[model samples]
Target: MQESVQHKGVTHFTIVKILRTFSPDEMNEFEKFLHSPFFNNHSTILRLYKELKKFYPLFSDKCLTKEHLFSVANKGKSYDDQLLRKYLSRITKLAEEYLSILQMRTEGIRKDYNVLLQLSRRNIKEIYTRKIKKVEKRFNNFQQFEAEHILHKHFFSALKYELLNKDNQIKPHNELLVDSINNLLDYFLIVSGWLLNEIESHSYTYDTGSKRNAVVAPIDRNMIVEFVENAISNLHSEDKDRMIFLEMVLNDMKLSSPESGFSAYTNLKKLVYGNSHKMSRQILQFYLQRMNVYCLLENLRGTHDMHLDLFQNYRKLLEENLFGSEGKTNLRFLEFRGILISALKIKEFEWAEKFINENVKYVDEDLQANVFHYGYSLLRFYTQDYSESLSHNSKIQSGLLPITIDSYILKAKIFYVLGHSDSALSLADSFRHFINLNKLISDFHKQNLLNFLKYFRAIIRLKAKNNIAKAGKLLAELQTSSNTREKKWLIEMTEDLLKLK
Candidate 1:
């Protein structure tokens, strides 16, 4: 008769003892057993463990760590080795649980598996068709860049898993996969730094304004193009990958040499085109941020064509994501207002008015005030509707957060537009006093105020039909001192006004 028996998990001593007792042939047999498909069943493996424990009394142990068991289970080669057997048992249990969960559609596992399967198929196709391999070989000179491409692909894989398994109950395993992907991304960052150093060294040739001609070999533009293209391709693979790629590309663009226009434009175009979506608001958000940087850089370099291209891209994005039926989110609305304001500053009135009318109701009180003020001010000066413009200006003045120098400037401009030369001159005088009293204007704004005062003063003189030559002199002085495109545009408008008089 069999005596009543109890079985416990394997301990370290039991594992060591089992290893010692196993002959080489027995160990080989055990390894085969551990690796066999028979060990894949969770309940069967647990039952076998209990049965073996009752008969042998050799596997009992209370102090075994899960990690140790996992190691032994994955690497053990002999069925006779108790430690290896126990690990196999544990793995079988885990896989069984995973399979059962998958079968049951529990916690969205069923849906996740479907998406995962599709993504896996796509990955296989990409790999088999040599798309990935081609990219890998194309940027061989920039290993870091190639590594980034690989890392982006891995990140997309992880993201697919995350989106598909979003509601899975087994968070620990999901987190482990996520951590592994992040580790790969970190490795890519290191590689990217190395590549950046190489590129910088190769492109170091620049004149320092000295008689000595310094010549540093420029990096191959073709290689840079290929790197950017790979990054864009990887980014378009998935949402998560796109965000990471855009952030890296934007940072690089910010630091890139002015001469790297092709690279900058390529990355910018990818960002604009690849993320044309309304569901994922982040796509538009990133697009706007990148456009802001691109536009500012182009404007600074006096590349009006490039600046206009960037602006038009932003306009299209606004039209698609902000005004379209898919538009949502307060942040996007605010961003739309900001973009429209920027367009107005460049005198793109048609675009500005179209955006304003479409987005009028969505604008908050403050933004509405500014939009009305800007639109009416332009209409007043250009269309000779001074009274209507002043009425809109009053609305803005009332809605302002607080009285600031900008408000005073707006008031002065309204007075000038309304042909109230005395009022405009008086408002300008008050602005000068306010600036001296509070020093609220930044240095940049100080320059802007000087230009504004000169222009408004000239306009007041012209309106009064007094000192025409003095107005002309003032216009020349303002034009000479103006250092910005917008200021120059205003100066040209003033010249047209003088000609009309």
Candidate 2:
């Protein structure tokens, strides 16, 4: 009799989920990893892995039945549920180890650090001294550095000092301990600065008037700002520029409003342009993300024209390939959409089209269709090809919440422009229902979209009536509204109404 097709928890196993994340190359490499005697000794686990590999990528329901797995992996042995479970568990552990090994290969210093620890435990003074000097040399010769490097330097110093003082036959190096403390403080200041930036960025969500949930140590942000400024004045190291950029970011965060943020923003842009080469890719990418956030915040305030600034920021990131590892782009769908929209906002049609074609492939395969259609639809809409725009927009069926909301909004805009008032208003109402029913969208975002719909309905009505004064009033409200999405487009639409009269 053929085995029953029930999955019986095999397909949904954690091993299957982990395997799904592996690329084709990784899958083949994992097979070799399983064959290594050092990593895996169980033959049945290998057999189980072979059975699992038959259905490699999907491991669909019918292929992952418990009965089938047991029979195939243990051809002659009688079915024992506990035994099969043990084999599955063992293989999952092996897979996890393989992943760790992969990570370890990329971090060579981590391996040496552990080796130094092992040497220290054995009190192999001669080899330990030689290895410590080698590692310190490697660290000194390193051209690029991260904040973690400072911490690692401190760790090595501590280890060296301990080794020297272990037997107390000779005095410890007092200078080494001081050097370690200095490195520790540098690490603390850098990490604390980053954390402070994050705290201030999200400070809008907190209610200061609400009762406290717990007693926490109060941080004086102004004190840190003052200390950082003082340090910048006295700094003479290679890290002077990096420290200066951190101070600039902190200053930008200190600005009470987006209107006042422009000076800080300009200073930051100039500093990055001059010192990007001195920074590591990780640091540069992180600060670029913050710069983009500042640009977006200022743009939302409706005072500064930041589209060109945003366009340049994205161009730098893309040119440097900082969004992904190994010289390839791997943008999340939302990030891809934001970049394309930024290019569109600046009317860089040719560059935007080329960017979409070049980078759409970097988005996950499942999201590629929606990203492609949405990008082309925006491009078509901007270039005034309404019919083609609608055609591309209709092709997006990803069921992703943001894509759905954007698709509906784009459809409504196209219909309104084409004089299909009834269809346009109907879609706008449906969009409202979608927003109200969905709990996934945060209150902040929900309010933004609802505000857009409110202004959208007003613009449609104003166009039909050709009320020039009301159009001007609508434009003014949209310009000043801080909590609305699509404010720029709505303002332009309302301006078109004034021209109509």
Candidate 3:
């Protein structure tokens, strides 16, 4: 598990991995752990440790070959793979055990709780009782305001009760712990129901109009709906700062009556505005991400006024460093791309340009250029600066499936808008060929994009001669197929075409 990927034939991974993560003091302690007869009786494990120690921090294969280790382990005897594997496994096992114990020893609560349990086993009743109380006292001094903190406290308290029960006379104070655990569970399930609702709604929205939505009652649909609705009016019943209740309400509104989603969004904004500092970074990111999702649903339902507001929210959160690293991660360029699009959709052209230029330093150096060019190209296209868009398009050289697909489609869109119908159709055919030949994309994405390209080529050719109604009809068939990229855009395009006609 420590190795990033499995090297099936490479036997050095287990031992090299152990050494790679060790701190200097930890490595020293591990040396002692290796020498101890209690932990290891074989001297060959020590030999392996000493040999592996020479390459600590960067345990590359140059000096770490299995055959070399076998020679060192068996005193230059004939190389034996089985003998080599046996000692390697033995050393790796001891290294893993040592780290586990070391981690336990460094954690105050766990270390102390373990000692108390050991004392209980020794029948040292007075010391065990005192130590248990001390452990409880220490845990009490912790900041147990969050649900996770309370849950962990409850877990430890229950474990203490289990240990105490082994001696029929001893008992731990676990009644309040049980209460806390139940309350925490209640909070998690209710808040987590929002996540479940979102997953189901995407499927639901496919059947209904993106304009219509309702909360599908969860298994306990009535209670959950009532509890979520009541929590909005009675925020005091649960601390919004620690529990994710407002997001739950938002999800409920998005499902139950998305016409009410904007109201729920307002409620969420107020709650987040008041409690952003009280929330942890992870929680804040989560709240903002849900708001982004709410904004997305609103956009799908044709709420464009809030676009700038949501764009400003992205800037505000990015300014405050509230977004998680993944929002800016180069690995998932799509998320970062969404942020750029948010700014672009609101017509924050300068801000989007500035962001692409300034924020790319956070991306992996290898990927920064690719992300920037892909994003800049879309920004240019959306702003209708077709030549600049084409420049950015030429600069894109990324092989990532999402980046590649968007780049190809963006070039097609630009050519269509620029009255280069011949170029657009040519690009679509080439893009289709490239997609078919490439295995990097999933079949689902491949099919959707291919379908989109087909319709796009048809629509582009038809619309050039003021046959806008024909273009609109071409897209109406798409409404029944599983939705593809730019469904809302297609709908809006169809509506706009019909308007012109």
Best by lDDT: 2
Q: Per-residue lDDT for 1-501 in model 1, tens only? A: 221111234444334355444455544454445456654544444443333333233444453433334434344442334554555546445444544543465323234434545645665544333433343244243322234344544554465455445435454456547545654754454355345544443332111333355344344334444555555566545556435543454444433456765565566566556545422344344445545555554443334435455566667666555433334534333355446546755567776667666666565645665655655555444444667756665666443322254457656766665567788788888877665564334444455556566666665666566555766776676555532323544566467567765
lDDT value for candidate 2? Answer: 0.79
Clashes of each: 5, 0, 3
lDDT of 2 by residue, 1-501 (tens): 234434364767889999988889999899999999999887878888888887888888564678788988889877787787888888899999999988989778888899999998888889988999999899888755467677888999888888878857466588889879867866776566567666654443222233365333366556666766776776657766446655654564554344456776777777777777766787778778778877765665556678899889989998888998856669988678778888999899999999999999999998898899999999999888999999999888898776887888889889988999989999999999998987667565677788989999999999888889988998988888876777888888898898886
Q: Residue 58, candidate 3: how far off, in angstroms?
A: 5.1
lDDT against the true structure, per candidate, is 0.50, 0.79, 0.67
* Stronger candidate by TM-score (2 vs 3): 2
For every model shown, what is its TM-score relative to the native structure? 0.44, 0.85, 0.68
In candidate 1, what residue range of length 10 has the lowest lDDT sum?
1-10
Candidate 3 lDDT tens digits, 1-501:
623232233434666766776888988889999899999999998987888777677876554677667777778588777787788889889988997887676466656656766786688888877777776787656532343444556556665666657667445556755655655655565456556656654542333333355455445444555655565565555554334544544454443454566676677777766766565455566667667765655553344345765775676568667644524433346557767888887678898888888777766678888888788788878888889988988898877776777888887877777778899899999998997887655454566677777767767666767787676666667565442555555555556656767
Best by TM-score: 2
Q: Cα lDDT of model 1 overall? A: 0.50
Model 3 error, position 388 (Å): 5.6
